[model samples]
Target: MSPARLIGLLAALLVAVAGLGYLASLTLLAPAEIDVSQQQAYVAAPVPAEAAAPVAPAGEPVGVPVVDAGWLATNAEASGVPEPALRAYATAQLRVDKSCSLGWTTLAGIGWVESQHGTIGDRVLQADGHSSSRILGPALDGSGSFAAIPATPESTMWHGNDRWDHAVGPMQFIPTTWDIWGSDGDGDGVSDPNDLDDAAYAAARYLCADGHDLTTGQGWADAIFSYNHAQTYVDAVHSAATAYAERTSR
Candidate 1:
């Protein structure tokens, strides 16, 4: 073969090899670009798609916390939380079907705060969860100490005055607040806030409003804050509730 022809043939072979290498490089980069795009898509929508599962059915709870008669009897006397009222709290927890379950100890905590489980000021809880006497707060006459709500009297005899409204029952819910969430706990057709059963259920319903998730510590704090605006009140309720839960879980 001639020398020039040999050089030309070598050059032609080198070009073909370079062209093949470039084509391979493009092929390799194509999937990488696609993979990067797929990653970006994943970053945009990272959550899993889930079905709308039912939580509680017909005002009944899906996960009912176990508070047996034995447990109830022991805690009731010690904590002044009545058995019927405790049962009512647990039932409301399940019945309300909030995403976050309202612990019974939390109810006990509220009981401790408001009226000491209906044992405050010579008042006592009856067998059916009714207080021996009305548990009313000082008139919210918008004075130096209390909130001056412009609400009229729901019932003068029950609430004690005509000027302003006061809270009722062990939970310290004002009549207007109770009217929104009042329930018939004993199924006798009357929704009385003076009754612990009705009061407890109403309290739970009030707390569970706005789909507030009460599972995390923050969620619990937020719920309590909503119930009472004071930071001190929220802290006290959380502490009391935590203590009760720690005690009873053992």
Candidate 2:
């Protein structure tokens, strides 16, 4: 109740007032209540103009290149092409000769199926003391004119130096046949069975020469058959050719 008590009481009162004012200011500055019935609308942010717009899918009747048979015959050297150049060459060749694209693809597939893309080998021994060998099939026919008579322990044909041989290379061409039919496919001036370009072009030429149209569906089938006489070979070639077309088109 004295002067000191009065001062203390006044200080307490001032503190209480200051606390109340701080709380009041906070409540007054607080966000207003959101409406219940009058709901707030939200809009998605606009996409940036620089953002790429969704691209529409290309419609059917998509442009596909068409290739000619005669052109393939003349450009048989194209098969010797390499890497990125090889792909572009193949694409261009197939585009112009897209009709024969199936034929080429079929040939490639057949080569794969027939000889594991030409990775087979064979050894033949002649009874007359002459020895000859092959890879893939028994050296075609006129390759060496030597008949493979199987091995002795096998009871198939030859006993010592006369026996049939396996095929080799990407196209599965016998060493002898390759010596004859193999050609430069990539324009590198060297015919190699291991070369995909050379192999592909050789196959194209072989099919074209084998009474295949290289331009029509039936021709494609015929060319495939000429490569190998197996039904599986035909089916595999067709499937591969179709797949190649689809991939290249994309």
Question: How do the predictions measure up, each by TM-score?
Answer: 0.68, 0.43
In model 1, the clashing pairs are 59-95, 61-94, 142-148
lDDT of 1 at 182: 67
Superposition error at 123 for model 2 (Å):
23
RMSD to true structure for each model, in Å: 27.5, 35.6
**Clash count in backbone of candidate 1:** 3
lDDT of model 2 at position 163:
49
lDDT of 2: 0.38
* Tens-digit lDDT track of model 2 for 165-185: 334444554444444455555
Please list the C-alpha lDDT of all candidates, in the order they appear.
0.57, 0.38
State model 1's lDDT.
Answer: 0.57
Best by lDDT: 1
